[model samples]
Structure formats: structure tokens, C-alpha cells
Target: MYIRERRRFVAMSLAAITLGACAETSVRPRQLAGADPARGRDAAERVVCAACHEIPGIAWPRGRMGGSLAGFGGRPLIAGRLPNQPDILVRWVRDAPSLIPGTGMPPQDLSPAEARDVAAFLYTLE
Candidate 1:
């Protein structure tokens, strides 16, 4: 019985090790082949996000319209709420009202590629 128990424990440990090694982390992608902050800024300007949102230096209607995006990399959440995970930002950017009903920020019409680029730029605001 003692030998059998030891064998079972070893088998379990091996299985645990295998599972841990196979597990994938949930971190987001930081960059793409040609991610440009200047391009992203241009896109940001195109959407006129700063027109109502207080986005960093490109301020418009102050008082936290959508709040500043400076130091966005250090933030754990966006819009004073929601996790700052890259995927979450993608969703928010793509469909703000859908992510959170009654959210003050409007859903800016950005294509998938454009949104990704914008996210890449935002990620760099550390």
C-alpha cells in the first residue's frame, strides 16, 4: 500500500508539471510589424476623440470627458473603470457602448487594423 501511494503521488506531480508547462498566459501583444505612434496620433485625430475626450496633450472639452490617456501603460483600468488589458481596450475602442451600457464615450468607428494600431500607441504611453 505504501509503494502504491508513493507511485500515485509521483504520477500526480508529473501531471501537474506537464499541465503547468502547457498553460498559456493571458498577456496582450505590444507591437506589430509597423506600429507608428505618429500614425496612431493621426488616426486619433481623424476620429476626433480628443474633441470631447481629454486625451493627454490633445485636450478639448476638459473635466475628464474620457480622461487623459497619458501613463495609460501604468493604468490597470481605462475610463476610471474596466481592466486595461489589451483585449479589453480593443473591445472598448471598437464598441464602447456595447462593452458598457451608458458609457459616456461613444464608439469610435475604427477598423480592426486601425484599432490595433491605436492600441499599440496607447500601450506605449507609459
Candidate 2:
């Protein structure tokens, strides 16, 4: 099953890349250059992102309400509303409703650095 899923992911990734879904835009370094994916992974656990998001590496929680972030890095948009770029992701992580009024996601208390770390980790899902 794992092999099958991996193959499916590869096929979908190829399709997305062919269709320009994963193209780097003017807003680049989508994962935040110099930010630490390892630290971000740790921060994700501390921040309890897994409480709402089904993050890639974290095992517990497996939240159903906020939806899975399985392939979020390759996705073209954030919250199906905004372009999925680094700055936008950082802002979204800091405060989701500010970016889009009435967004289901609530504002988080992470510092700017922590937000960057979380964004960095999230972008690794691709």
C-alpha cells in the first residue's frame, strides 16, 4: 500500500509539474531560505499544528476538521484563496483571518520567527 501510494504521489506530482502547479514564481524560496525544516518540525509539535492540521511527519492528532496537509507544499494556493508563496504563507500562519476575513483558521500566537519556521516545515510536504 505504501508503494502504491508513493507511485500515485509521483504520478500526481508529475502531472502538477507539467501543468505549472509547482513552478517557482517571482516570490520564491517558497520554504523560506535559511529557515530550518528540522526546527520547524519541532516547532510544529510544540505549536500543536497537528491538533488541526494532519501534518506530514507528526503521527498523533490526525485532525479531520482542518483537513490534511499531505501535499500542501505542491498546492498552488493557500486556503484555496491566496497564492501559495513564502511571504503569504508566513502571513497566513501568523494570522489567517487577517488575510481573508471569516477564514476558518484562527489567528495564531507564533512569533515572526516561529511562523517562518512553521512555513518552512510546511513547504517540505512537496
lDDT of 1 by residue, 1-126 (tens): 999999999999999865643331124444445656667666777888776655664545444566677787667667766766666676787788888899888889888777776776777777
lDDT of each: 0.69, 0.82
Q: Write the per-residue lDDT of candidate 2 for residues 1-126, one digit (tens) a residue.
A: 999999999999988865664455433447486778788788778877778889889999777778999988878789887878887888998899999999888888788888888889888897
Candidate 2, residue 81: lDDT:
76
| Window of ten residues with lowest summed lDDT in model 2 | 20-29
Candidate 2 steric clashes: 0
After the best TM-score superposition of candidate 2, give how far the Cα of residue 31 lies from its true spot, in angstroms.
4.5
Model 1 residue 99 CA deviation in Å: 1.0
What lDDT score is found at residue 91 in candidate 1?
Answer: 76
- Among these predictions, the greatest lDDT belongs to 2
- TM-scores for all candidates: the values are 0.65, 0.75
How much is the lDDT of residue 26 in candidate 2? 33
As a whole number from 0 to 100, the lDDT of residue 9 in candidate 2 is 100
Model 1: colliding residue pairs: none
